[model samples]
Target: MHSNVVGGSDRIGEIIEVRGADGTPPYRVRYPDGHESLMFPGPDCVIEQGSATAAAGRR
Candidate 1:
């Protein structure tokens, strides 16, 4: 996810839960650091599908 603050570090995570319907806010994501957060992504945030190779590497 993109940081709301200028020059802040951005993060990438796996979406573990969605609280509402499609295109809804307040998603639960588990980061690589093993931490999870409920987030409402802002304009700077983006979501991309993970590739098969990437997924395999995680396992």
Candidate 2:
């Protein structure tokens, strides 16, 4: 996800849980830095299927 904060770089993380209905928004993500957050992605965010598996492989 792209950070809205000025000077913040893009964030990469794996979706650990889904809080939305029928696999919608409000995802629980775990970042490479070992921090997790519940995210309601904005317009800057890109959703990719199977990206979570790829992210896990990188860890």
- By TM-score, the best candidate is 2
Q: Candidate 1, clashing residue pairs?
A: 1-11
Kindly report which residue stretches of model 2 are placed more than 4 angstroms away from their true locations once superposed.
5-7, 51-59
- Please give the distance, in angstroms, between residue 25's alpha carbon in candidate 1 and its true position after superposition: 2.1
TM-score of 2: 0.73
Q: Write the per-residue lDDT of candidate 2 for residues 1-59, one digit (tens) a residue.
A: 88899999998887889999999979999988899999998898987778666757866
| Candidate lDDT (C-alpha), each | 0.83, 0.87
Estimate, for each residue in 3-59, the C-alpha lDDT of model 1 and write its tens digit: 877889988888777897885868898899999999888877898877979877876
Clashing pairs in 2: none
Per-model TM-score, in order, reads: 0.67, 0.73
Q: All candidates: CA RMSD in angstroms? A: 2.5, 2.7
